[model samples]
Target: MKETDIKELNERIQKESAFVDMLNLEMHKVIIGQKHMLESMLIGLLSNGHILLEGVPGLAKTLAIKSLARTIEAKYSRIQFTPDLLPADLLGTMVYSQKKEEFQVKKGPIFANFILADEINRSPAKVQSALLEAMQEKQITIGENTYSLDEPFLVMATQNPLEQEGTYPLPEAQVDRFMLKVIINYPTKDEEKHIIRENITGAFPETKAIIKPTDILKARGIVREVYLDEKIENYITDIVFATRYPAENKLKKFDGMISYGGSPRASINLALAAKAFAFIKRRGYVIPEDIRAVAYDVMRHRIGLTYEAEAENITTEDIISEILNTVEVP
Candidate 1:
C-alpha cells in the first residue's frame, strides 16, 4: 500500500500487461476490429471471472476466444448449446465400462481451461444449470465423484440477440455469476474494409503464443496484491449500497429505473474487476477511475430494471452512468 510498494507492483503489472497485450495483438491478426471487446475479455481473464458476450452472429466472438486460447497455450473447448441440449451432454455422465467392471466418468468440454459456451441462450435452464457448479464453485460433481477444474479456468459464453425465439432466458442468479457482460457492436467502415481486403487477398495474419498458463496465474496473483485504499473501498461500498436502497441517496432517477439492485456478489466482482483494471492500466493501486471504468460491465447484468423503466427504453448503461454521476467519489 505504500508508495514504494505501489511503484514496485506497478512495474510488475506493466511487465505482465505487456505479455497480455502481445497476445491480444496476435489475436487481432485473425479478429478484425473489436478493441473494446478484446480489452474486456482480457480484464475478465485477469480478474478470474466468467464473461457473457452478447452480439450478432459473425462478429468473431468465438474466433476471438479461440485466438486468445491459442496465445495463452491453454486447452480450449467449444460447446454449441441447442434447444435439445441436455445437462448430461454438457456435464458428462457416467458410462458403464465392462472392461473396468465399474462406471467411468467421461469428462466433458467444461474440463478445459478456456470453455466457449456458444449460443448459451439456446439451451434450456436445465442445460444451463449444468454449468452453475463449474462456473461458481470451480468444480463439477458427476456420479458421486467431484472433480476440480484446472487453474485459470474461464467460461466465455456468447448469445445472439437477433434470434431468441426458442431460447431460454438466463436466470438472474446465473447471470450474476458472470463477472461481466460485454456487448460487441458492428465494426467501423474502415475496419470492415480491412477485414474484407485481408480475406479477399488471402493475407491471413498468423498468431503466435505469447504467454503460458503459468504466466496467467502469476498475473492473477499480482492483481490480488494490488492495493485499495480505505477511502476508495468506502466509495465502492457506498455505490453498491445505493443500488439496494436508491431513496436513501436521493436517487430519484433510479427509483423507477431498477426493480432489484446488485447483490453482494456484484460488490465483490466490482472490487476484483477494479483491481484488474488498475493492473491492466499499469497501476499497482486501484484509483477511483478504475472503479468508474469497470462499473457498467460489473453491475449491468446484476441490476434489474422495472417495467416502466423498460417501457421507457431505459438501459442498464444509462442507469449505471446515473449512479456514477450521483455517487460522490472519495
Candidate 2:
C-alpha cells in the first residue's frame, strides 16, 4: 500500500509482462484487425477465465483463437457444436476393452489446454452444459474416475448471433459462466484492404509460439497480485449494485429498463478482469480506467433487459454507458 511498495511492484510487473508485446507481435502476423478481441482473450487467459465471442461468420472469430493457440506452446482443440451433440461427446465417455475385460476411459477433446467451441449456440442445452460444467469445474468425470484438467486450461467459445436461424440460445445461468462475452465487429476499410490483399496474394502469415503454457500459468498468479485498493473495490461494487437498483444509484430512469441486474459473480469477474487489464498494461496497480475498459464485456451478458427497454431500443450498452458516466469514479 505504501509508495515504496508500489514502486517495487511496478518494476516487478514490468519485468514479468515484457513477453506481452512479443506475443502481440506474433498474433498480428496472422490477424489483421480485432485488437479488442485479442486483448480480451489475453485478459481471460491471464485471469484464468473463459471467453465467449459473438460475431457473425467470417469475422475472424475462429481465426483469432486459432492464431492465439498457435502463438502459445500448448495443446489446442476445436470442437464444432451441432444440434445432435451429446454430453458424452464433449466429456469423454467410458469405453469397454475386450482384452482387458474392463471399461477404459477415452478422454474427449476437453482435456486439451486450449479449447475452441466453434458455433456453441448450435448445440443443444445438454451438450452446452457439458462444456460449461467442464469450464467451471476444470475437471471431467468419466465413468467413476474424475480427471483434473491440465493447467492453463482456457475455453474460447464462438457463437453466431442469436438471430441466425437454427441457433439455440444459451440459458442465462449457462451464459453467466463465461467471464467475458466479446462482440466482434468487422474490420475498417484500410484493414479490410490489407486482408483482401493478403488472401488474394496467398500471403497469409503464420503465428509462431512465443510463450509456453507454464508462462501463462505463472502470469495468472502475478495478475492476481496486482494491487486493488479499497476505493477500487468499492467502485466495482457500486457499479454492480447500480445495475440492480438504478434508482438508488442516481440512475432512476432505468428503473423498469432492467429486469434483473448482475449477480455476485459479476462483481468478482469485474474485479479480476480489471486486475488482469492492469497487468496487460504492465502496471502493478489497478486504476479506474482499467475497470472502465472491461466493464462492457464483463457485464453485457449478465444484465437482463426488460420489454420496456427493448421497446425503446435501449440496450445493455446504453445502460452501462449511463452507469459509467453517472457512477462517481474512485
Candidate 3:
C-alpha cells in the first residue's frame, strides 16, 4: 500500500471506530477492570468469532458478557450447563400443541443474540456439540424446519479451570471451533477493593446501551476491510507453520513437545483476529504488534501438547512464547 492510501485508510478507520470508546466507557461503568478480557471480547465481536473463557468463578465472566450485551443493545441469554443438559435444551425442541393438534417449534435460549454458556464443560458431549454446532453453523434445526440465528450472534462459553470432576471436557476438534480461548485472572488489589466496596454498598453501576446491534454488524464489515500487508500475512503463516513443523522453522526443541500443530482454521482465525485487533486500535493497517497481541489466545487451544510436554509441566503458552520470540517479525 502507498503512503497516501494508508493515511486515507487510517482516517476512515478513525472515524468508523469512534463508537469503540463510547462502548468501552459504558462497559467500564459496570465492569471494574479486566481490560484484556474486555478487549478480547471486542476482538471476538468484531471478528465474528466465538470465545472460550477459562477462569475460576467470581471473575465476572458472566457479568462481562452480560454487560457487553447490554451495552450493545442485544438480547442476552445465559444457559447453565449441567450433567442433564440435553441437546434439545440448548437448541429448540419440537412440542406437540394439543390445541393446534400440530407440532410447534419452541426455540431454546440459543435464539438470543448473545449467549453465555456458563460452565460449558459440565454438560455432556451431546449438549456441548449442540451448542458448538449452533456456534459454527449460526443456525438451529428443529423438527423439519431450520431457523437462522439472529444477526451478530456470539457465544461466550466459560470453563472452570479448577474443576475436573464429572466435567465432560471439550474434544480438541470441538474446541477448535472457538476463535479465542482467553484465560482470565483475578483482579488486581486496587480493582478488588473497588469491587468489594461496590458490592458491600449495594452500589452496582448500571451499564447503559450505547450502540445498536446494527452498529456492531456494520463495524464487523469495516473490520474485515482492515489492511493486511503481505509481510504481515507471511508473518502469520510463519507463526502457524512453526507450530506444525517446529523443527523445520528453527524450533527443533519443540519437535517432540507438540503432539499436533494447529489446523488451517487456526491460521484463518489468526489473520482475522489480527485484523480485528487492528480495528480495535483504530488503525487501518495491521502491524506486527497486533498479531503478537492476539497470538497467544488464538493459538493456545488450537495447539495440542504431547504427553511428554505435559508430564514435564510444559504448557502451550511456553511453546507459543518461544515461537514468537524466535520467529522473525515483519
Model with the higher lDDT, candidate 1 or 3: 3
Candidate 2: clashing residue pairs, number: 0
Better of 2 and 3 by lDDT: 3
Look at candidate 2 and tell me the lDDT of residue 142: 89
Candidate number that wins on TM-score, 1 or 3 = 3
For residue 242, model 3's alpha carbon misses the true position, in angstroms, by 0.8
Q: Which ten residues in a row have the lowest lDDT in candidate 2?
A: 159-168
Error of 1 at 94 (Å): 1.9
lDDT of 1 at 12: 79
For 12-42, candidate 1 gives per-residue lDDT tens digits of 7777778766776688889988988888888
Candidate 2's displacement at residue 256, Å, is: 0.7
Between prediction 1 and prediction 2, the one with superior TM-score is: 2
lDDT per residue for candidate 3 within 1-330, as digits (tens), equals 688887888898899899899988988888899999999999999999999999999999889999999998999999999999899988989999999999998999999989999999999999999999899999888988999999899999999989899999999999999999999999999999999999999988889888899999999998888899899999999999999999999998888999989899998999999999999899999999999999999999999999989999989999999999999998
lDDT of 3 at 190: 100
What number of clashing residue pairs does each candidate have, in the order they appear? 0, 0, 0
What's the candidate order when arranged by decreasing TM-score? 3, 2, 1
Candidate 3: residue pairs that collide: none
